[model samples]
Target: MMKIGIVGATGFVGNRATEVFLAQGHEVRPVVRSASSADRLTIKNLDYQIASAFDQSQLADAFKGCDVVIHSILGSPGLIRGSVEPTYKAAQKAGVRRIIYLSSMIVHRSAPAIGTTEASPLVEKQQFPAHPAKIYAERKLLKLREKGSVEVVIFRPGIVFGPRSRWVSDLASQLSQGTAYFINEGQGICNSVYIDNLIHGIQLGISTPSADGEAFFVGDRERVTWFDFYRPFAEAFGVDPAQIPSLPIPEFHHSRKRELISAVTNSQFVQKFLASVPEDFKQNLKNIVPKRNKSSVAVIPQVEEVKQVEHKPTPVVNEMMAELQQSQYKLPFDKAERILGYEPIVSFDEGCRLSIDWLSQLKQFETILKK
Candidate 1:
């Protein structure tokens, strides 16, 4: 079994990586920032090292004697300037042989209709704050690979989702509460990578000779509109899919403007105005963005009859309520099978059931608290 050192092992991706490696019977040394954070990683037959990624001496010590090092550190846009070089040098000084870095698909050039790929012009563009940093980090890894025999593999995945995930959990919560929205007709196509599948891809990179010193796009072959992605979630939750309403793009934008204005004009009134709006509006806005490639294009709804629906307790609002009343959150899994040679052992349907069960238990506990 390979002796693997996992930096940021307590993080979302790093934790998953540690689990995968341990399951493969590899000896894993999980590097965490604090002893408290180390308690969360309860994997059997694994060792833990406490160190901050930014601390060169501590990182170097943690990486010593590892066959391969997986750098799973998170960064805002412009990570190249932030952490890449320091981590690279640390790994080199630690005598590490290979490095696997997790990056985002957004760093690649994207087509007008499709998402970005390894060969996309996005690799050259320095527009987005995140892209430049990701690209620079990947480049630095490549340079290190060229300078020595160190093998570097860059895995760029898009919209990673799974249990205990920030995005997926939030999405499931919104759908369960009957409070989700689509932006601009929600036609923007996006690539999604199931976290389990991502782990599989990372393993594949480790074993595959061709993957060394190269970058690969790790995502499900199934590309869908933002709306379609959420529709399955409704079905999974045992809700009426048709009850979920689609908000007009213009109206959503207007609401956002109002929210910004309220926040600026009256801090005290901001909370009240926000409370009056839909609970899911903020979460929905956070997830949805206009198509990056076709920024000006709007998603035109296919059904004209549906468009005439009045905007009071808006049809969209009523639809969400009805859907919530009937259904529960359902998770989707397909990308793992076609692309990553794996499938989510935990289905979205199962996830919804568990979440609801947990919530119900929490509610019961709260009732006891009141007594």
Candidate 2:
């Protein structure tokens, strides 16, 4: 058994990876960004190391004595781009043999063409900022692999979902609140990878020598659409997927106004300026500006036939959902199968059942419905 260090262990993927690795008789080191983050994972007898994700020295120290390091950090584009080089270098310093990096199929546009493969050209630009950021990080890792001191394997999975995933948990929460929606009548292809399948890919990455310096797409063998994806979720809550309400496919420019305001408000200079402003002045400025009605009509277009949704998703969420719901193709994992001997152990039906069972354990259905 090999010792493995997992960065971002508090996250959905890394947290599950730690548990799986430990159960498989491998030594597991969970490297988190803070003590609070460390508390997020509580597997018995497993201790986590605290370090800044951007610091090579700290990551090196945290990874010390591990044979492999799995990088699963997720955050802003800056954090995402900044962490790659430090992580690989730190693994080298810690004498680790290999690094498996988690990337998303989003690197190649949210809606890739049919038959898209690892070699398909990536989008030069994308609506979601994370897409470009992931592309940049993957390119950086490939460049670092030229040193030959460490083996780098990148796994690009699509819509990772299962227990504790946003696709499951967040959707459950939304569905409970009557806020869930789908665009294009939920006809889009959902290139989903069950969490356990993804973890299995990581295992393959660690053991397969041919996988070194290669990027592979890993997802379920099923050719399911977004409707197929959400139907099980809807059934779990006794809600008909057909009654979830529908949103029209949105044009990119439809959200430009909100996006501009978000960009300005989140700018560092604007934040600093707001901090320096007196409370009275800030309050006065706020009072002067017109306040939008709290119960304004939904911004995105909704089908007129279905009853209006009580709670609409935010502009950002709506746009993302629209993009995902508009997907027309699935990215193939043939390369992963050919090289890493990877196969999805959990079928879609089984995965959905397990995810809903986990939600049941949390009493989410009872708790949410009671509200």
Per-residue lDDT tens digits of candidate 1, residues 306-355?
Answer: 34443333334333222222222122233323344444344433443443
Name the lDDT of candidate 1. Answer: 0.61
Candidate 2 clashes between residue pairs 3 or more apart in a chain or in different chains: none
TM-score of each: 0.65, 0.84
Candidate 2 CA-lDDT value: 0.84
Candidate 2 lDDT for residue 197: 96
- Candidate of highest TM-score: 2
Name the runs in model 1 displaced over 4 angstroms: 42-45, 78-80, 109-116, 123-128, 248-371
Which sections of candidate 2 miss by over 4 Å?
252-317, 367-371
lDDT (CA) per prediction: 0.61, 0.84
TM-score of the candidate numbered 1? 0.65
Q: Superposing all C-alpha atoms, what RMSD in Å does each candidate have to the true structure? A: 13.7, 7.4
